[model samples]
Target chain A: MTVTAPPARGAITAGEPIRLTSVNKTYTTATGPLPVLQDIDLHIETGEFVSLVGPSGCGKSTLLKIIAGLIPFDNGTVHVGEQAPKEGRRDVGFMLQQSVLMPWLSVRENVTLPFAIAREKGSHIAPRVEELLELVGLSHSADMNSWELSGGMQQRVALARTLALDPRVLLMDEPFAALDEFKREHLGLEVTKMHEDMGKTSILVTHSIPEAVMMSDRIIALGARPGRVVGDIRVDLPRPRSAAMIATPEFQDISRQVREALAGEDGSIS
Target chain B: MTTIQTPPQPAVVRAETVPHTKPKDPLLSRTWVKVGLPLLVLALGVGAWEVASQTGLVNPITVPPASDTFAAMIDLSTKDYFWHAAWITLQETLLGFLIGSTLGLVLGALTGTFAVFRTALWPFIVAIQNTPRVALAPVFLTWFGFGMTSKVVMAAVICFFPVVINTVAGLSSVDANARMLFRTYGATTSQTFFRLTLPTAAPVTFAGIKTALTLALLGAIVGEFVGASEGLGVLVNEFNFQLEVAMGFAVVVYLAVIGLILYALIEWLERRLITWSN
Candidate 1:
């Protein structure tokens, strides 16, 4: 309930005070209007790292998309910063499960894309590109295209691209789910560190319970079908979470709570 | 930016779904074996023809030996008139290719970008594309005369469709996630088109260009058939009048070799432009 704090005023402003009040979404299937989300309310404070974990058909991605202003909800007011998600989208960066890096462009060009779109061609953009690549640890492979890099490396490039615009709120949809466990844990640590460094609010939609516990300040677990927040727990394990922390009791306990929340009445789905 | 995960659970990543761009040795992949195999078949075909002609099994008048035709080609290359005619054909083919590809690319991009424009003009474009180029050649000749203009226009018009279809396809096949990433960043329509859509479509467009370039030569030849002062197509027709079958065969050989060279040039450009070229 503490995490359900009211969003600040305005639907359009900087990326702060992301608020979703009574959000509802229904997808029209061949059978009829199938409600995907119902009466969901959540609030994320500035620079807070939150993870939404749930079973399949929980509308977790839909929720992320709703927050991202990428899809229309049947009802409910969602606000990013003081403005609507649509109006304030410029300050919202997104990372998908797939690398989504343009294969034809070099790693350097892919990351620089948003910069070029947001601003005119200027000398300043080059340094920004370097800074981002350094942040993502992709400084060496800047000249190579996605085909030349491994999946994990390509995803890192995507992370760099998302940050290129310097959005205040980052919406991640299982960004590292496709990566192996070793990579998933490695990237999970790096991303959390990066999140702390940037002080940007992030909402990660993930299926991995441990990942949610490892990186999140708060973990929101949703039930199956018409997903509603089933469990909201504060991850007080500590900041700058390490790979070793995954083996600790506090991390295990937090992840267990998340898993239990994910395992709902529809137990088999998770 | 946020890619969809339909199922909340971990779906196993299929090994076959992802494309592997492992570069096999470029030279080794396109080995001499591949080249030699085709040459070996061609040799067998030509040798059989030569034997058939020499044994009087096939009439030399109707089906001249490959040797006679190749010798005619060598002899014709020495003639200033043949060179001038081949040069004219090449010029017409190239000019037509350039003009047609430009028109197709620009128009395709424009229509692809705007739904209203596509809806309004697509019918007309389809009609023009479907009209037989050979049927229209005589009309073009009447309007522009038997000069290179008619041939060039014909070549351009004939090759136009491939670029349009391929460019539009390339433009549409842009990864939805990439488009969403652009939209999430508030990229303008022009920005998305130029940055994401156009670049993604470039390789596909280049493929279309290759097809169009080859077709350009065919269009030029058809134009020459309508009426022309000089061209390889005209040379074939001239030889036909005198019943010089070997000479006609020689013109065809020159055309095929020219087409092969032009196709190779397109492949070379594709290697340079396409970042993920296999």
Candidate 2:
């Protein structure tokens, strides 16, 4: 696995390392205090693609949310680049399982939403929107309503929207979970290509082992029941990974390693 | 983020269910079934009324023949008095709806957005809404007088609650994921309300406005009925006293036509404003 040296402090850029130290999260439920994550220590280098794979009760999504600054952790220090994780940081883009596009807005308008919210003004915005749509292959459907697009196309539009502000750290939570095998694989390859082209630090949470192996430079296997880091296996596969790589011995070996790491805890890899 | 702790089961590919084909109704397929049927029912109703009146099956004093009613309508049309009354009622309904809906929208928006306003104002709004609006017509007449002002006030009062209720509901119905997305974008409270909440609430708010419009018409008529020198309701009362039952029926028909026109106008506006909803 290639690990880029950390940039100088206070130097924010397109790609930044994410560091989490002893992250602990507990949900105060009706029954009692339910611990979700315990002592999670992760260090993702600049421009590295990481995937968090685990069973059903694993706090993979929760951990991702913590890094995204969507929720607070009881005990931890999370750093996105040199700064503490903060909500609505222009440099951090968080994408969820569902597309969650505004039904009323057109595809172009949806992509331009972040700029509108920030009240950004410039001649550059229109061109940037067009470029993003082009990147997502939704240029033809720019004027169409979000609801008119298919599930896969909508997800692509969402990907475009997430990259609207050129966020450095892209956190995805089961983005392709709802898609079919064909679309899922197709989108996985597209995202890998985008990651390579843009060189943005990305972390994805998924249930599928092959998805994790196909996309990530390193697969962080997590265990359930007070989720903690179980295994951190580095993928020695070639860069610019394609669908054909999934059938290779190296890809299968890395997938087996991830599955074994997950199997050690609950033997319940869904 | 509800947790599912079920044991891992083998993935089951669901067989696509065959689409159920609905049997065609032969009679319903005809254009006559859609249009001619209602007209036929109406004709039969009018014919039955005429027969009953001619055969003295009911009191002619109260139940006038359809022909007599049409004659009364023609007679009323010739006079400027009926038109003036209708004009006054329309003005009252329009003004009242505008005022009431605006107030309701503002208050509802406040209540939905801010917890303090919701807690402080919600109970009072409910209490006032619960009080029958028609019952307040006499009080409105006493306060605003027997002119168009009183009827306008009555209509506004009647129109207020539905808008408030629907507005609150519409504002609350915003998707959770959308709210999270807005938060992630660092949107200000007002920005979120305007861009996300307002657009989300529009379809529901329009529904309330449509309902409130019809109620506004009813409110105006009721106010005129209680105490007014002009309006279609006043004409109906006068015709009753003079035993011109057919004339009262004619005035009712005019009110129905006005109601239909108002409803159609609202529907057209709804389609224009909420184009993406469809």
For this target, which candidate reaches the highest DockQ against the unseen true structure? Answer: 2
Fnat of the models, one by one? 0.59, 0.66
On residues B1-278, what C-alpha lDDT tens digit does candidate 2 reach at each position?
42322211211121222454552877865787868887999999999999999789988879999889999989989999989999999999999999999998988787766667767777787788778869999899999999999999999999988888778777777888888888888889888888999899888777888888998999999999999999999999999999989999999998999998999899899888998762
- Per residue, candidate 2 scores C-alpha lDDT tens digits across A1-270 of 233243333233458899999999999999999999999999999999999999877899999988888899998799998888777888889898889888889999999999899797778789889989999999999999999999999999999999888888999999999899999989999999989888899999998899988899999999998899999999988887888898898888988888778776874665
Residue lDDT tens for model 1, A7-66:
232222234768999999999988999888988999999989999988878899999998
How far out, in Å, is residue A108 in model 2?
0.9
Considering only chain B, report the TM-score of model 2: 0.88
TM-score to true structure, per model: 0.83, 0.88
Off by over 4 Å in 1: A1-15, A27-34, A72-75, A87-90, A120-125, A265-270, B1-45, B117-150, B226-229, B276-278
| lDDT string, candidate 1, B48-122, tens digits | 999999889999998888889989999998999999999999999999999999999998787666666567666
Candidate 1 docks at the CAPRI level of: acceptable
